[model samples]
Target: MTASYGSAEYQGYLRNDAVTIAEVLRLDGYRTLMSGKWHVGGSYKPRESDLWTPGDLAHPTPRQRGFDKFFGTLDGSGSFFFPHYIGEDDCQIAVETDDFYMTDAITDKAVDMIEESVADEKPFFLYLAYTAPHWPLHAKEEDIAKYQGMYRNGWDTLRTSRHEEMLGKNILEGNWEISPRDPTVHSWADEKNRDWEDSRMATYAAMVDCMDQGIGRVMAKLKQLGVDKDTLILFLSDNGGCAEFLAEEGWVESYPDISPEGKKIVQGNIPNLAPGSGKTFQSYEAPWSNVSNAPFRMHKSWVHEGGISTPLIAHWPNGIAQSAIVHTARHVSDIMPTILDVSGASYPKDFDGVGIQNLDGESMFGVFLNGHGEREQPIFWEHEGNCAMREGNWKLVREFGRDWELYNMAFDRTELHNLRDKDQNRAERMIKEYDAWAKKTGVVDWAVICAHPAMDWVKPAKPEI
Candidate 1:
């Protein structure tokens, strides 16, 4: 809901994007289940370690977020061996294992939830938001082993390979050109040695491979439960694969680094020393992050297509004739109405005695079923002041407090060309509309929005009784 691999434990500072969706679905009479990171809003203080201790889930959890059940951590990063989380009913599992990785555990629990939901013969709205490929670069030995030397080619090579594969798969068309590497990243040749680069990518690839396997497992469960064909599953990342500064937070390693011959080589997640764990902090760094986005201009936290444009794969045998038809018309907020359409549920004017905020998205059910769109609503995003608004083929995007640039999305999906001067009229109109919407939404200034300071402004005023 929020993003894959995001800390499920919502902190006090964040917003409950998931809760908003789940609550609306509940009004539709569907049982909701969420597994994975739910970084909505709550206490994520590291000192309060029980924040993730699974056995003692307190109030303001997924249940409060609209999920009937949840299994996830409060913090975004932690060790796999001593993974911490609170189960359903805020019951602290406090489960720790040398073998259990959080990604696998989250998926397994999701699968189990599906089984129970199916057995009960109730339609379930399941959100399996994963934390794969997130920071800390932790992975199981076997998963890590599978990726040994796989990233030796480094980000430069892997980025090229993924780009080519996506092309063959028609994930990309010939229309878009791959962007150059980010200037901030030191070129591979510029790096002092290859180990830091290779290990960083190796860990990341492991994260991706491990996530793919878990996804396959979840798909298997849906197929097993006889809902694979009917259930609508939309797979997407919250944002682009994160290239956040890893040095500051440190790597949360699950396994010690080993040589290709299976001998311990480098300590994992440690910063400045080797790219490794526990005491050491690390990230895949900037250059490779540029590669991760590929074809797109920037990594996460930026408003460019690379940072915001993600692959949206929708699968529903009963609803879609296109098995893997890629749709560029939808946005993250579109999910709310899409689910309602498929399930024939109605959004509540109010939930739990509280008036509801009007939804920012409309159902995309028609596009899936008719092979065309029924509606095209303006979509807006303002994460950390990297703001963007899309209305049909025209979009207004900008870095907060920076100049706003316009683009023709249909022709410029890669955003290589700017239409600021060429389409001043269109830009002005969209900017006007954006301003109006911002006012309507109680939009904060760029500085506050970017920092994500407490935005208690009412999206919808309280409804009269």
Candidate 2:
């Protein structure tokens, strides 16, 4: 959804014509508040004004995207400590304290927004996007200390262990094999600088742990306000683990080597430099990311299972059935329709005299209650040159500039086996469907974008997928 849809021009900014869920909810008398990672639209620096407010009220801002209140950054990533581009409604907010952590700050603001909404006696829709566990690998020392030495065994063994655990818990069927270690990743035994690699993954875990702690705080706040059971809380990750290396060519040149807090930002795939320091902008890289998306091939950006698959958690004691796990495939787009269905909100046929697009997703409230359901349309994905389509038990996928590969998702969800050669006609049929969909959606070919000069620095085999 964040990608360049329809055309390359649609890539970065959230188009003005879009009608967001929050907008519809506002019509139904709900207050919408968002805190954290507002990458959908807007500029961090307002040219004409020096006001420090919640969000920019003007063009291409989250406030324009139906969020009445916004507190976050405009970009995908940044220093988690003293993030340079934080915003409050209509203006930029300067981080003045040395102890500022982005995850904690986002949560704190969300809690305050919730309290204010309660005091105002208004129902609220809060989009609290925690930019935790993302790149730049920044985590508190105490959080980093908890996972010290935990990843010493390396990604190869860790992937296997995680797969085993998933199998034991019936989270995955026994028919699948843990896909082999990512081709670009070295075997743990063959890896030199083992201690440093271990530290990198430890820091990544620490970021996730710290995020969990913050989530606990938010949940505690909800409970304290007596809204725990009444409020429906849904949590999800946008994509699978990221394998992109930041030391690629032109990256350091593009981003500065100093943070807003005056700390020297370390850049590169340095072996000895420990991550989780506020001064580093390093990624955990492919090997560990491979472990994070265990049993699935590839990482974020690719059209692979590991790239797009995410665990969705929904908690509503008064509404949803408890302890139910739905294995049915769902897309992120389904979130809007589900919320609208629950709230009895209507998607406008026309807004401001222009026809609005119909929601792409179906209401998933049934899945919450019945623990199983089916989507009417086949799932489709395209990023870079990678593309995939899933329909029932069959999936057809291909890497950019590569031949199509087919798999029976029911039997080979790990994508370890290719059944394309065995069923030529089925593959051809699905390819035809994908082609029609692409044409209708005005999808720009990857060949067009990949050749652009801006993509010159992207390394081919990293986990950036």
Candidate 3:
């Protein structure tokens, strides 16, 4: 429902009326299970009295929605070591071990859940929503050690190297060029505290590395269960690298003051003290995030390619004919329709006496089989006042309170060139299309959303929708 953190409209949670893919699968006789982050629901606390009631608008837990089993944190981001609001089914759980890492713990539960589902002799759908690679950048010592000093060459070199690697592997197609480095970022050679900067990226890499290892463990479990070939596994990130820094005043109040081991949590990007420890809370910050979204412009929250573009990898040994990179532009909404198409489930018009919203995305099953999919309508996106619309190769995008810029994504996916002035008619037509879509989707103006009384605590540099 496009809910922002601490917003009064949604109270930072998903609305209850929205039908989830898990619910549909459950109705189709699949044992739905989930582990890891569950940030869509109301804030879950350790206290039983604080739990959400049935009538609450933003309090539908995963179990309540459709999952037969659920285990994860209710909040979006938290300390990996001593998480703030962890839940198992309906109740909260405490961190029982000194060395308990959130990523590993999530993997453990996922493996266990798979075993239980298999033992019950029912087909299962496991949603392993790992909260790795998000802020407070925390990772295990071993994972951090592997990436130590790896980023000493800095983000600039990493960008060039990664872009070349992607091109060589044919992952990028059609005359795509890397966008220039963000102007606000300093050249690595001119930067002071190179060691600290390198450490930030290293810690971030370690978090991802740990998550990858956990994924491998899940794959191994699938193989052991003799369902590796039959099961369909899709992997994708929620968004691009985040550029948000944990430097806001009184930010520590949002998190636990102390760790589970009674250690005081040291917060913010302190230059001297490196990240990756339970006691420290830090973010990779913008400079490294620019590297994370290498060859693309901008970070998360923007409608730019860098913020919205992410690879959707599908692995189904039995279903897919061959491994190939598909350059089709697909939205996150398409995942549900694709799942339903693959599983032979029907999308109901009504569920539990409530009308279901019409699907905004088309099934991507054709793309999976033939590496191509057709869309009847253009894709539209609006996040934090940054709006964009894409129809075939043409794209119209604009930052808040700015003139629209156009690009032919076929030749300039990085959006380095602007065509709005050259093709005014096309730009105007796309703008009208975007406006119509926005109005139909009930998209509120950025200024109006930011001015709401609920956002008084938020002091953003720009209006956040």
Candidate 4:
């Protein structure tokens, strides 16, 4: 009915939470399938982004969790080709197909699972998280070819254009101001290394476009299986477009990984050295990443809106409300319970002696029954330097330990107006609420988390704050 998922540490919780979801769903005899990246444990290599085999399956892997099937990569970064991803019992396909991209691979697996379920006449749950357009951005030759010079206009133009498109599509509200291009990403025309800059964004867009095609493939399969109408598909990014290329050179022509044990590993170096070939070594770089997170400030790690915000599209012909509606109040944690509600699963109090955490989410499944109703639950998020609490339209957010900023989300979606000083009493109340939530949720304050852990790759770079 429902599922838990996320990046690294978050995924760890998701795995544990999914177990909670599955045991409950089993009471109703429903099937759950997970197909995507599961980056939750210690990386197998010295580097964080490396993708390879015999990954450290030390902790609870997807197999141990509630998922009957799992398909995904271990580390975050990888060459698109011959990625370190592997499928679970059913997911581990024995394909010797040559030159198959990871995005296509996962989609194919999902389609296979769906077809299998249809044959078995089983009502199923599927988590299809595309690892594309993330890092090590690589795409099919034709996909990369489609955007030859599409990004020559630079991020400023691209971000503005995409923002306009989102608004035109009614995907964005009338009040939000498109955030400016990130200062870190230089304009292509002004960039000294024009070839590299041009290739970077072209690669990023190609990755996204390629994934879209892969989604089309999955949809086609669903239609063929005649489950297109009955199935529920939730499409969204895990977080806002990431901008984590800490090193100036995001691409190395070759991705080099050396294990803590000193074993040198290159991500599908063969057949990938060629520019157009989708391989694991390359990343889309920063300029286009700026566009991927349109009209939002900051990237993945920051607690800012841009870092945490994502466009969520819920579609199910049988279950979804017909009217196109936007539910701005939902958070990632809410997804699990919502799915559970649809499949009619109960949340078990205890499973295998491991007591499950209470559901931090409420089911908006009622939305399908009674239009998109108001969320009775408040939205809360904390990760890295970002911390936010949403009670109705009022939101309180702070970047790291900096002073809290207040915004009336209903009026100022971009959060350009800071009402902290203007509304001191409200700000104080919100801060107190956030402090309580942070303590309750095990949020490791970035100031403390990074300091003792040597958070960055470059060690001992202490936080000035």
Q: Worst 10-residue stretch by lDDT in candidate 3?
A: 456-465
- Judging by lDDT, tell me the better candidate of 1 and 4: 1
Q: Per-residue lDDT of 280-395 in model 2, one digit per residue for the tens? A: 77888888889989999999988888998888999988888757767778888899999998888988887656677767888889887877888888988888779999988889
Cα-based lDDT at residue 329, candidate 3: 84
| Alpha-carbon runs more than 4 Å astray in model 2 | 1-11, 42-59, 453-465
Residue-level lDDT of model 3, residues 1-465, one tens digit each, is 324544344356655456899999999999999999877775543233244352255577888788999888776778898886678998877778778899998999999999998888989999999999998889988888898999999888988898898889888877588888887777888878888888888889999999999999999999999989999999999988888767534433456658656788887777868888888888887788888897899999888898998999999998887778878788888989999999998888888898877866888888778866667678999987899998988889988888889999889999999999999999999989999998887777888877766555444332122
Better of 2 and 4 by lDDT: 2
Q: What TM value does model 2 have?
A: 0.93
Answer with 1 or 3, whichever has the higher TM-score: 3
Query: lDDT of model 3 at residue 133?
Result: 93
Q: Give the local distance difference test score of model 3.
A: 0.82
Over the full model, what C-alpha lDDT does candidate 1 score relative to the true structure? Answer: 0.66
Tell me the deviation in Å of residue 114 in model 3. 0.9
Cα displacement (angstroms), candidate 3, residue 20, comes to 0.4
Clashes of 4: 9
In angstroms, the error of model 2 at 382 is: 0.7
TM-score of each: 0.83, 0.93, 0.94, 0.84
The lDDT of model 4 is 0.65
Q: Whose TM-score is higher: candidate 3's or candidate 4's?
A: 3
**Which candidate gets the maximum lDDT versus the true structure?**
3
Candidate 1 structure quality by residue, lDDT tens digits, 101-156:
77888888999999998999988998888877776666666666676666666666
lDDT (C-alpha) at residue 310 in model 4: 83
Instruction: Give Cα-based local distance difference scores for all models.
Output: 0.66, 0.80, 0.82, 0.65
Per-candidate clash tally:
35, 10, 0, 9
